[model samples]
Target: MAVKGHGMEVKDHGMEVKGHGMEVKGHDMEVKGHGLEEKGHGLEEKGHGMAVKGHGMAVKGHGMEVKGHGMEVKGHGMEVKGHDMEVKGHGLEAKGHGMAVNGHDMEVKGHGMEVKGNGMAVKGHDMEVKGHGMEVNGHGMEVKGHDMEVKGHDMVVKGHGMAIQCHGMEVKGHGMEIKGHGMKVKGHDMEVKGHDMKVKGHGMKVKGHDMELKGQWYGGKRSWYGGTMSWYGGKRSRYGGIVFLNW
Candidate 1:
């Protein structure tokens, strides 16, 4: 562990610095290795925990934890089994509400976390986190929340959804969603499924790349780099190609 100005940086080999609690400025902090376990920086004050095991690792803090690879908390109290998970704040006891996972890689959990649906599962890139606004994922990653942002050559974003999975593609807020092909966008109750792709929300913005008309359906009308926009159900859409935008 290399001690920087204040924030203790942990590079490579995480096991070496296990259990060494450092101070993040004033916020007590502690980090563990890949397959190790460590208590929170504030312990009971926050009760954050991190438990990891063979490809299945988790970082728990502020009531959030990331349990890896099919872990079973075989206790007489809270019996919850999970793999690659990050759960935090929001009074934990009340789970099973809206759980959103990114990629094939992670989960987030914690307090003040707004869960949607009685049984909602979001697929991300091997990253997960819950409560108090938490996220876990990297590279070609996708995050679903009230506000998400991504910038780069390859990127796709929807209403509160930020997805980056390609090259030369950059997408901004809800006003736009770019999927290669000169900014291929999908709007209307935005939902990215198998074949059909929908991008819907209050606002959107996209740029970068250009190509043939693919698919699009929205409520606005505009032309960026020769892209067209359509409208329906009193909503507006400014698309450049074919998109699946249906209620």
Candidate 2:
């Protein structure tokens, strides 16, 4: 048997099986929130699987995966909650952050892969694992924040998978890798190739700047690019202005 949830909620359940295979896939099952939550025993020879791939506020178990075969049993994301979440493959991949009123914020992510006669993989953003006599792989990524009352500017941010926030800016990228700026003010520009990067400032400023060039010169009076000269803050004061020269 196979079960999957695209846009719905499945809750509260018990199961018992012998000499058979069972599969659970997609959103909430056997629990209060979204996805499948397993409870009970006698699940011998039972195979179960679950996947949650959607853009919604399910509130629990964003992307969780579970698989079982033969007399073996495998479980992932027994408990989950948050938004923009994802759990993929036979292993669990919990990614994203939880909310907090006046305390610390929590975030987690997990990724794994395995292959063998009897292998298992469980991954989560804020993840935990337990298995035996099988090949198991697990990975987690998390970020926690403290209170802002004492520090005056306290902020907590977490992401189980990959989290990006643009308070007042723009970003562009493709696939898992990203290239762009988190925040840009005026005339400054930047480019990068990686998984994550953040920028914050105002007026012609590049927060995370990376430049590669050959044959650059800085003159005493002003900056010159071959024969053309330009000042960063305008051509008014020579001593208190910044300049850039390209060749």
Q: Which stretches of candidate 2 lie over 4 Å from their true place?
A: 1-78, 81-174, 178-247
Best candidate, TM-score-wise?
Answer: 1
Give a tens-digit lDDT track for model 2, residues 84-141. Answer: 1222232222223211111211111121111101111112222111221111112121
- Model 1, span 93-120: residue lDDT tens: 2112111232221131121111111101
Q: Whole-model lDDT for model 1 versus the true structure?
A: 0.24
Instruction: Return the lDDT, model 1, position 153.
Output: 31
lDDT: worst 10-residue window of model 2: 146-155
Please report the candidate that would top lDDT against the real structure.
1
